[model samples]
Target: MRWLPVLPAETGEEFSREGQPGDAPAGEGLLSEGACDEHSVRADVEAAAGAGIDRRVYFEVFGCQMNKLDAELMLGVLNENGYQLTDHPSSAGVILYNTCAIREQAENRFFSKLGHLKKLKGERPDLVIGVLGCGAQNHQHDIFRRYPHVGIVCGPGEFLRLPQLIDEARSQGQVAALDLDTPVRFERKENLGPRPRHAFVSVMRGCDMACTYCVVPRTRGPEVSRPVNEIIEEATVLAASGVKEITLLGQTVNSYGKRLAPGRRIGLQHVLYGLNQIDGLERIHFITSHPRFMNPDLIEAIGSLEKVCEYLHLPVQSGSDTVLRRMLRSYTMDHYRKVIDQCREQVPGIALATDLIVGFCGETDEEFAETVKLVEEVRFNGAYIFKYSERPGTSAAADLQDDVPEEVKRERNQVLLGIQKRISLEANSESIGQETEVLVESLSKKDKTRWSGRNRKHQIVVFPSQGDEDLVGDLVTVKVTEVTPVVLVGERPGKGS
Candidate 1:
């Protein structure tokens, strides 16, 4: 229910088009300019710690679930180091904007927000302005040069050093904590403020796919999976804190445990099986998977596992083999179809979704038709469609020509959206009159009289509120009454009528 600005399309591909963290979920300061040595910075922080100064820190999270989890990590680290959380940026001494560079719009939005923080800094001399995560990594030097008032800029890899970096940034004029190659230390166990019923736990960080159009690998660094034990511990702690549902997050979630496997190998199936055994956990979900890693074992586990939810966010960036080859996606349309077929056969009633990039560097009309044909064959329950745009430093930008015109891109985007809308509407209508369970989350932003939650298929369901009993965490059964493209209008069996 906590509203955070997130780009759903960036959850996987270049944009958060598919497998966004939620169905449709939805800083400041000024400081003196000075530089200090590490020893002095450390001594000042230690002295402040000894004096027990609990400064309030506010976090502005952007991007995907991975970024959200990273923000949680930041908050946990700050909390551990004698810092408190504040909802208001005006009241906080530290204002951190956890960013994403997946889309140009998201990056532009962050900078626009960053510009506003300057006014806050002008008002308060001691406010610490920091940028973390993807945006921090993507525009490391540019950000510092553009905004010299920004005291702290740490990438995802350098997150563990945040507590120390905060001190260094305060004492030093501008501190850049950009360490991409080194693996982050996430072994510590801590909670992110108040626990929600549904939580996102990152199983891994970064990507190795090296897709031509993606900036994730450059920003988040190489893939690194958390130890199986560590993930289980985090899940157990979440379960213990009344979290009924836990969504596993990663750039390529299906490719988890690749680096951690010693020899014989353990995959996401093993991890899901472990989490299933944990007490108090009801449903398990994972997202943003690559097609190449969608193995039969993982598909079978999804069908067999009692706790795993039946929703898969398999990204098919392009259906045309040529575009795919150019993107270096490592899998063909036939391969993708086989994976979809296997998943359909194994996991009955699975709600399938996909990410689509309509305009790629060299996409021809026939190639674009191939993508439409693939979508028609797949009939995805939902999709995140995007018009291709070049990202700086990506292979597509450097090696490939952006030949697709803007008008053509927009036309293709609309065409795909039209097709998918019919498919999604049909899918939702099929659920009419059926009973489904939902973990009631919060009131609908449009109508507060109605409460909202997501079903097992990850569809949003809104029903009339029943008695005001703080039903955020309660699981209730609702009969489907009406259908919308993105939301299902339902009511408690015999109560709302």
Candidate 2:
């Protein structure tokens, strides 16, 4: 285990939700590729069956879907080491907070939670408290300095080494494994536990884009595409284990194979084609693409592939070309328009969504208007809107001034959000009385009488669950009855309807 320099202990207090920490990095992310076989996993479980019967670990995950998947992988490693997963933090001997540093808000929430965890550590000194993921990568040993009781600080790439780190921390008081240069090695024994009906499979890890305001590249290291055969093998395992849908994950998924060895440079289209050939997988999806790599062939694949869902999340950070240039996004408004046009033309009725950042550095009212105009023209089915917050070490923070005032940022954010809410409502309302396929996932928290799932367009549809059937994991026909901006309320289709 590598030793991290322990910083001067600051008195642990309640979470303050204070200003951004000076060391906060860009965004939250993960990148790794490895294949695990079944025999080794079974052997580990058998060996640890008796030892782990009483040990429990509680995980608090934050940020993106990638972070959630990382938590799952870490749980698998802990399980193999004779630890069981628990939901309540107080009941567990080990508590892990999978941290995120995407924005100031996320960071504040994490620190607040960590501050609260300090009391639990004081009460139970034997309990192992650790922080993992992007935030851990950003602060590293400094986390030890701030929260002296924190036993381990590990990054996303260092997750596979978690068991060893936990043991070493128990023996030596504090440990950190924040190395980004090391490749993640997933041995055959590292089983990612039970498979759900729908799962996220990371085809590639890391980002190569030098977007001014983003820290994904720094936290996740360089982009590394997993071998196509390895991905296929993992998907095959998922299908055999009853997974019906698979969403391929990456920071910029469209640039799938650019960083592979000389002869293995395959595009996203080839990988989609290969996944489409899998026997039991019913649907496929990929996300968080950059327009620079959204070539014509990729659009053609989206149009032609039957298994690939009719949904794409192409994040257009800003609508104004000036803003895009300053963000170092490498694409213009006209180029983005062309990509959107081609996607709409090729894949009709596709539900397009985007990630929009309002009030970016130096954004004027006129530039903000351009964003509203783009939103009106695109009429996106859904969007994730965010107010710009400078990330330390990012080019934007280093070179540009965060000139947009808080009031201006709030105004622009609300304006765009209002437009998107209206558009989303109108778009969803159009689906009423239409029949669609929904893959049942779970009981709706809002209404237990109904089950929730998503359609090919990636829209959530909730329908009454006729208790006679096990709808979970099954794709069933639903008739839309009512619509909301966020979800569609539906019912099981009658024989004729």
Candidate 3:
């Protein structure tokens, strides 16, 4: 097992003292006053080993579905090594946070929760705390300095080394495996024990695009596509274990095979073709596609594949060419429109979703208006709108001035959100009285009598449970009875229609 060199421990002191008098604010200081004393650390580990310490881990995931899959794989590894999972942090002997560094808000929320864990760590000195994923890669040793109680810091690429890192942290102090240079490997085991109906399979890692307002390149490194055979084999295992649907994950998913070797340079369409052949898998989906790579071959595959859903999540940061140039998106408004036109032409009634960032650096009123016009023209089935948050280590933060005032950014965000809400409501309203196939996922959080699932277009459909029949994982026909901006309320077709 590979381990990063441990940070030298302070001599002759307990490892629990987190902060000292007149130290820099909560997350800035070096090693705490009494942390990582070699003899004491060994004693703690030996004592815990002698007592047969509880191996319950509380794992919390943040950010995208990609992070969730990483946590799932890591948990599977831990389970193989005699560790069990727990929902409550207070009851667990180990706590892991799989964090994201996509937006500033996510980072802030993670720090707030990490602060809360300080009290928990103080109470249980033997408890092991770990920080994983993108945030760990971005913050590295700085996380250890800020929160000395953090036992391990492993990046996304180094997740397979987590068990070894945890043991090292217990014996030494503050072990980090933040090596983004290494390629990420996915295990073929079934990891989604809780959600067996659906799973996320990461087909590729990292991004080669130099979008100015993004941090993915810095956190995840350059593009590296997993071999096509590996993905197929993983999906096959998932299907055999009762996963009905699989969503391929990547930073730029549609650009999967661009970095592979020439002989094995099969694109996402080829992978989708292979997965579609799996007997037990019912649905196939890929997310967060880039316009530059959504080639005709992929579009044709989506239209023709029996298992691929008629849904696309293509993010267009801005609709103005000037803003696109500034953001280094490498696509123009006209080019994006052409791609949308192609999808609509190829697959009729396709549900479209997008991500839009408002009030980017130096965004003029006219540019914002162009974005509004594009939204009106496109009328996406769903949209996720956000005010652009300047991320450190990106070109926008280093060079471009965040000239858009906070209130203006907020106003632009609201304007786009209101437009999308109206459009979404109208789109869903049209679905009323239409019968669609839904893959039941689970019981509704609002009411136990109802079950929640998604249609082929990726629209949420909620229907009542009939008698004692367990509808989970079943594809049932639901007649749309009512509609909201976000969900479609429905019932079994014969009973309601």
Runs of candidate 2 exceeding 4 Å displacement: 1-54, 186-195, 263-265, 495-497
Candidate 2: worst-modelled 10 consecutive residues by lDDT: 30-39
**What local distance difference test score does each model get?**
0.73, 0.72, 0.74
Compute the lDDT of residue 263 as modeled in candidate 1: 82
Q: What's the ranking of the predictions by TM-score, best on top?
A: 1, 3, 2
Using alpha carbons, what is the TM-score of model 1? 0.88
| Candidate 3: segments with Cα more than 4 A from true spot | 1-54, 263-265
Clashing pairs in 3: none
Model 2 deviation from native, Cα RMSD in Å: 8.4
Tens-place lDDT per residue, model 1, 136-155, is: 98888798889877999899
Q: Give the Cα RMSD of candidate 3.
A: 11.2
- Residues 365-399 of candidate 3: C-alpha lDDT, one tens digit per residue: 99999999999999988766657777777788899
Task: Compare the candidates by TM-score and give the number of the best one.
Answer: 1
Better of 2 and 3 by lDDT: 3
